[model samples]
Target: MQRFRYRFDLTSLHFWIVIIIAIISQALKAASVVVPSSNCYVLDNSSRIVDFGSDLVVRFCKDVESRSQTGYVDFGRFDRFNHFVAGSGQVDFVQGFYNGDLVKCEHSYDKLGRTAQVNIICGTCPNGQCKVGVGCICNVTYESTCRVFVELAIQCEKPGPRVFKGFTVGFHPRTWEIVYDGMTQLGFERSHQEFSFATEQTHVYLYMTAIASLSTLVQKPIVKTFPDIGLEVRLSGSGAAGKPPTTLSPTALVVDWRCEKARDTPYEVNITIPVEGYEPIQFTLTKMCEFTQTQDGDATRGWAIFGVLSCIFIILSALFCCGGFIYKTRVQRQHGIDALPGMTILSACLETVSGAGQGYTRAEDINSAFANEASWERPVSAQGTRRQSERKYGAI
Candidate 1:
């Protein structure tokens, strides 16, 4: 029994020793972890964190695998302008940095405080020897490569009135490209790619708050309609009129109240932001104003002038008809068609056409007028021959 107890005690001690060793191994592995996955990496060696305000922060780290010839890590040499200095064989990463070299660096919320990286930029080391902070280390050549710059992407849940604070350079994650804040995202670039920018406040706030500061600086109005309430408004692009924005800020915009034609009616404002390789961002905005607005100028004035002219013309026509009827019946003693104003004028026109320029005369006197003509007189001999012929006919 004593021999069996000694063996059991020995086995138990060995098992505890093995368990402690495994725990120590895991802790050491975590402390020096480098690249866990292709999409993510850690700055475990000689890391330096640079906080550029709340919008962006960069962590410059030495390559974990690099065996630095010098005792210290190389963060790369920078000029006064915060640009990387390149040797003869090395390419420039500052001038055309947006074309490439900008990697996505996202700081996630976790207990480990790990920042995941989507892409990596490697630079060839100057000498054949490897340096820790030059960039990602390459195995083929003892030389090292490093990530020179990083980018952060920010997207707004609701694009409200963004004021033009100034110009800024930012990156687009979907397009995997970098651009200026005012640069148009066209073609494949129109993907609702996030653009890095700073707001008036360091923390999240309500929308349209920037308009208050920009209102005093605005010189012109976007829409012609006069609203019952006037509030400062801003937008990403120019006004709805296609005119340029009043302020120098590219995002500074003027609210176009004329979005819908129907007035005094409630409606939803549908906004669509396209996203490539994914679903688009869509939301609706409700009007804040209580009353609807119409265009300026009294529309009824034009119609009023027209109505007055019409009434005057109608009254004059009635008066003319009444006066003509009374004169024809009482003063002229006319009857039948002649007593009617319209018929009298129509008959006069017909008489003028039938008389061929001769003045008006009775229809029965037409024959008398023809007999009095000089051309109607016959010769004396022709008249005597006609009388002899008549006497012969009578004798028969």
Candidate 2:
């Protein structure tokens, strides 16, 4: 079989070029997964209770005198009013309004306890005996048109700045007549079945259901805000549906807000639904602008380090291969083999088999032997012999 020679030159510029190209391509491919503009922000203090309010009421009562068998009785009491108190424990004021002839308000705290309770009482009391004495009687009346005002406090757990895009509010289908008193006061206007407004506050409330029921209402309300507006406000906490009266309803109402970019100023959203069977359900939401570093930045840094390390590894590996190739070639030359053009392993094996039983010698020895053989095969020409004969005759 004919033998073939092959060489592997690791030190060649072409080999290094290929290795570098491969490493660079891999690094570029890894970097392509990250989008510079599409950075993600994590909600740090998620689902924290920012504010809560319950047991709100507005009373309209006047003192009146009554006659009794013993003498006259005077007592203080409420005649006409509107009031509602839902949820207990950690409840605070948000906002409220009552005016004109409206009376009687009731609500249930799905988050606090499942049990239904009368939280609000409005209107004048019926004829009743004064509690001061058995023989005494008292009468309470609402004379002039009165307005009721009830406000609750909201509590935020971790107040900080945040960035959000939009928000969504859920409501019950059956309770579509409940008006959002707090949202109305915040400058929200209702058009048809939708209510929307914007503010600079970061804390809001959602009110739903005057009583607890087995059936729940889930309504989603749209939020309207300037997309370019960025607000810097504090992020307190969030509440979901169901827990204490202060907490959101688990099934009745839900709210979700998404943030795209951070804003320099904060914004607020208020919603109200006027349902038939229940009072208006009102809530408020506050958006805060937060400027915090995200994980994508850190991941980008990690990828850069990894790419650098990979390039270093590839370079070291190429150097090692090239060094080994050079050393092998030098060793072959020292042993007197023709290693300048190098041979493949197969070709070397074939050459060894063909030259088996032959004496090994240096390249110089082989060259000299060929030269001596060529000298022996050369013949003298007739002219040279004739010239030699002539010279001999002359000498004789």
Candidate 3:
């Protein structure tokens, strides 16, 4: 019993270990964990104003990963930029980063806590230009009296009006302008949308929640955008009302977005980030969920695992029951108990006693014990009384 109990404890430990291992394996295979998605946006250049407002579709694709975590990831970078201009006159437009991205950013002193990432500019500009080529720059250039300016604005549905703010690197305030924030004494200037930028460096803040003190009051802001929104890139030629259009929206700084994971997503914003001295380019960033997902693969794996476990259980149960029965029968036989059935039972009894009782064969014992010798001797006792009496176990 002590040995059996010890064995049973060991078996129980093994069983628990197997269960834990199975559970972990299944969890890993499930791909149900919440992870960052792979969603991106295509800058696809900027489309100019031709028919009041030109229609443009931003082509996007979801790069699905091949694994069990099929469709559960979100987050991507802007990738391509292609612009089309088909206007006979100059157009008006505005372009800037989406405000939704800015407000959702969590700011803290710890670098690890920040979820946003800033891509460093490549050292090789290809051309002899600086911030105007790769970094965010807005170039607004219009004819004679029409002044152009690059502006940054953030919109949150918070209290206090509509929560609007814009920052500029060029031009002065108009008193009651939509947003009154800008860099320098008179804002920044346009350096043309080309590799040869001639504008001075100006640091303008773009609605970043960077203050550690404001962390308590500023939660993530709600941002909404319409990808189908179209803006007219109004441009007036210096000559006449009807003239060939010039590609003003510079291609020097075209930003695009793309999704790298397998998941569906939707457009988070639609903004026209304008280049300095160039037309305001219109573009949209959408969110889509379409990364590769599992097709009952987890369930299939579970079935396979269960099948193997069940077979092992059945085999063990059969072995244990058979072993117990054989052991019990062996013990009973040593205690002189009948273990055989039918004719074999009688034979088994005779053989067992014959081994103990020496000089007594099974057939001789049966014959001499039940023969007429005892019965014949019993008749002599009856003759004394002139009586006939016979019995199998008669005493003389």
> In every candidate, how many clashes are there?
7, 65, 66
Instruction: Please name the candidate that would achieve the greatest lDDT relative to the true structure.
Output: 2
Please list the residue runs of candidate 3 whose C-alpha ends up more than 4 Å from where it truly belongs after superposition: 1-210, 218-292, 295-396
Total clashes in model 2, counting residue pairs 3 or more apart in sequence or in different chains: 65
What are the runs in model 2 whose C-alpha is more than 4 Å off?
A: 1-216, 219-224, 227-396
Q: After superposing candidate 1 on the true structure, give the runs of residues whose Cα lies further than 4 Å from its correct spot.
A: 1-92, 95-287, 294-396
Please say which candidate is ahead in lDDT: 2 or 3: 2
lDDT of 3 by residue, 100-213 (tens): 111223232322221212221212223333333323322223221111222211111111111111222111222211112211111112111221111111111122211232
lDDT string, candidate 1, 1-396, tens digits: 999999999999999999999998765322211111221111211221111122212344535544334465333322224222221223222211211121221121222122222222233344434444524332222211322333222211221222122111122111211211212123212222122112121111111111233333323222212232342223333322233222233332232332223334333333232222212222222343344344322467877889999889766765666566556655434444333444444344454444443454544333333333332367877655644543211133
